[model samples]
Target: MVESLPQTRSVSAEAAAENRAWVSDLSSTGDRRELASRRLYDVLLRAARSEAGRRAARLRLAGPELDDIAHQAAADALLAICGKVETFRGDCKFTTWAYKFVIFDVGAKVNRHFWQRAGVAFDEEDWERLPARLGVGPEAHAESRDLMAAVRRAVDETLTAKQRTVFVALVLNGMPTDVLAEQLGATQNAIYKTMFDARRKLRTALIAAGYLQEHQPA
Candidate 1:
């Protein structure tokens, strides 16, 4: 008898068929691949532009700057999609899957653009926002202040220099992981690992100080 297993979600028949066509055309040789590549790039470009439009105001990008970022994101996404096309599993529509690549590229580009235009610095305002961001309110203002103090001490005393820098920039200043990686000449995975370690250390410190429960997930 066959053992029962968890069922995996599958795309609709129409989505599956479209996905197959995209994979096939992109994987084929010569003229067919060229035409498919153009079509795919257009799709990626539109997705990139849409995301760029959403982020432009916040990032202070406009006109040529916005267009440049969108175009570059589309180009990068196209390359990424081509390399990973074979990995497509059709759990969603091909366009939906493809759109993720462009969106991520746009975010990375926008972040990099911000850093290039105005570099990040340690700001008291950003630090002040942290307590409020953590849901600390006037109801328990005194207790919240204590928690913030404990967190500050943990950040300064417990974490390593690299960990402290990463946590402050990423968690406090809202720097993107990709931009941080570029600035520090580290891999995105490395930055993420450091952030994870920093958070764990802070959680442990908070727990020891009676600010958090031992069973709580960081």
Candidate 2:
């Protein structure tokens, strides 16, 4: 015959008191702190991942490089969080601050990749020379497949042949002034003059063709 199992007793008052005390101690220090830290980690990780994905999509990065970029961005975000942990005043949410770090890290990574691929040197001289090389402002010309043709026509109709060649060599081809001078068998000063004349003529042509507007005489 099978024996009957003994019934379990309810928790005694003393045991319950000890359990409550243990729980209170844990809540006062370890458990609460662990919960807070876990929350912060979760929020930061989520923000970093979101920013990484957004940047990758914006830059149209594909394959393993995209993953590497995102990983690097996440690592940067975590490092920033650790460095600024002392300054977390709890005024705003930690996630909000983390999001800014994540975005900045991802943007910086993307810029570095693009600059490297394009062979752009980041210096004051390079910055100043950029407009002469890349043309005017960001939206200086309309986006079209026939943009080069239109630009050529504008140059031919407005500028002399030598000025047009100088403009193309220096601006579109990213040739240095010294190199352009050597190629054209002219002095750097002469190249500069040709570029200036080409710019003026092109501006006039653009304004006349309604591609650009004339500024109020100032």
Per-model lDDT = 0.77, 0.56
Indicate the residue-level lDDT of 91 in model 1. 74
Model 2, span 1-218: residue lDDT tens: 11222222444455444433323332344666456545545565566566667655434566777667766777677666656554543333345555787777766666555423433223343334434343544464344323344555776677776775676556643556775675566899998988887777777765665555587110
Clashing pairs in 1: none
Which residue segments of model 1 deviate by more than 4 Å? 1-9, 119-173, 176-179, 187-218
Which candidate leads the pack in TM-score? 1
Output the worst ten-in-a-row residue range by lDDT, candidate 2.
Answer: 1-10
Which consecutive 10 residues in model 1 have the weakest lDDT in total? 1-10
lDDT of 1 by residue, 5-37 (tens): 222367766667778888888777799889999
TM-score of each: 0.62, 0.41
